[model samples]
Target: MNPLNLPFDSDAMLEGLRPWIECESPTWDAGAVSRMMALAARDLADAGAEVETIPGTGGFGDSLRASFPHPDRGRPGILVSGHMDTVHPVGTLEKLPFRVEDRLAYGPGIMDMKGGNYVMLEAMRQILRAGLQTPLPVTFLFTPDEEVGTPATRGLIEDAARGQRAVLVPEPASADGGAVIGRYAIARFELLTEGRPSHAGWALKDGRSAIAAMARKILEIEAMTTEDCTFSVGVIHAGQWVNCVSSECRAEVLSMAKTQADLDRGVAAMEALQGEADGVAFTVTRGVTRPVWEPGPGTMQLYDLAKGLAADIGFQLGCGSAGGGSDGNFTGAMGVPTLDSIGVRGKGLHTLTEHIEIDSLAERARLAAGLLMNIR
Candidate 1:
């Protein structure tokens, strides 16, 4: 069933991936993420690819662009996109160390992305060892801020994707080992509430609580969720001292919609919430956003190619849309064919229990190698 006949050992692959998992490259820690990017850059350069490290801006980590040499190196070719940053903060390894239990491999950022990114690298290494060149040149773009909607690297991702033949994202595969052909629109908002602070015991009636006002607004925003759109306030901060009425409170809000129109309406509703609440001043500031990407003919065709490759590797690859947008959203929205979530299959992304099915490493690497060798 193996079309490429490339030798792959799951155990060896996991061993190679262990270092990546151990390196905690959280999005907010620029130095930590840069170290991770440096590791990747070394591997890419050693693999005979021309690597370029693009420094990060806005307090983010550096990005990498690696291009493989081909007769048509300058022509349109395949672009592989992935993120080096993760949601897990540093020191997570102390509690969630990289370990293998039965068929699952556990670690911070393993299943969500490091596992998939490693698999792609292995695929490329195998292809090179086999002394074969792909039909088209391959380029790898690893960014450092995808976990936070790529606040600093969106332009780099889009610029690299433009004029490319196709884009492939190695985000964790779907629950059923499927690939993503479309993604929903996503919007982020920052909410702030400021109120008059007073001594809790001395001026209980006169004091206005910012936390209370923020809590009410959070409930109101979450209640706006519908089948077509969803909303959640994930982060909140308020009240430095317990004895005093809170003077300021802030929260981060996230909204996802199946369509751009629905997201527009949601944004309008969120922005309209900026007003006075019982002497508390409330404001909503819009943040980064990902546009909706619906499957087009080119995307379907790319998926079809991947499906055939998966079948040759002894699996049926299904295609569907997904939430939690990836870099594919940018390329897909730009009318370039994109296939996402073609990485290792696993569960519990962004949690302490995050892990990947150990067996999916070799299996998915074969699929990735096939795509690299056959895609024209």
Candidate 2:
């Protein structure tokens, strides 16, 4: 019953990841992402996985779920999570070019997660080929728009994962090859300010500058942060001309929090700051892109079980946390024991230099296959 000693074909896993990275699935574009998911579903079917599609919730693209229902007794179903979309656009792949040099496969979306997707699929293929069935069922849920937000797919992810015993999110293997058990909540907000405009030199005091108001608000917001919570005013736009007092200005703020209390405190502080500025009118639109992937009561139990399985196989399983969010965040927030970063090792995600380590691919496939065999 040792899962680690199970056979794995590293070349098969790498071959699966190759064609996926060559395809560009951008977040904002629906057509490309849709095509990618359809292709993946076909491949998974070819590998013996039964596939289903949750119709898009009026979003740009759809979310797909693949499953290998088990016929064994006393086993629960485990959900595997990954995102199908990338941060790159249509022609970015050809422009930047997808190239494999030595042990590295470099291309758009290779690391951020097309590579991770392959790791999951190949693991399942190996398990099926090995004629090993877990005590429970195994399912794969892939979503689009994870780079921007799971706006249309968050609810679907939660619904699909509600009854699952555990979730494995193959986002990316950690920078140090560890798995992530926790991730910070991500929130983005836009603050727009309006004020009266007048000639700066001709009647300086007669006009109120919206840019000045926004500057003061930014300072106040930055001062409200502590160790557990952080906020940044990343983009700001104000003023049409140097001689004229700015009538309107806007700034986009990105916030990250480690816990629910921290997120609530940050939200309250932002509201207060927005209300404090009386001279300038303001409008704020805040979006909760992803909630912190907090570990629930039975989370550590699953982690321990996975570690035991890893030890039985031949590799070691280490758990850690990530500052960024993934589709795992949506499932974890819905009270699932979601374990993330169970994917291939890749570096330089979301940049033109993105690459996946060839050596890491096979190891990841082995890890995922071993985990699948042990999940009960």
Off by over 4 Å in 2: 1-12, 72-76, 196-216, 235-249, 276-279, 312-315
* Residue pairs in clash, model 1: none
Taking every candidate in turn, the Cα RMSD to the unseen true structure, in Å, is: 1.2, 3.3
TM-score of each: 0.98, 0.86
- Cα lDDT tens digits for candidate 1, 1-376: 2335799889999998998899999999999999999998988888788999999999999999999878899789999999989999999999899988989999999987988888988888888877878889899999999999988999999999999889989999998889999999999999999999999988877889999999999999999999889999999998888889998999999899999999999999999999996899999999999999999998998999999988878899998999888889999999999999999999988999999999999999998988888777
Residue runs of model 1 more than 4 Å from their true location after superposition: 1-3
Overall lDDT per candidate, in order of appearance: 0.91, 0.79
What is the clash count for each candidate, in the order shown? 0, 4
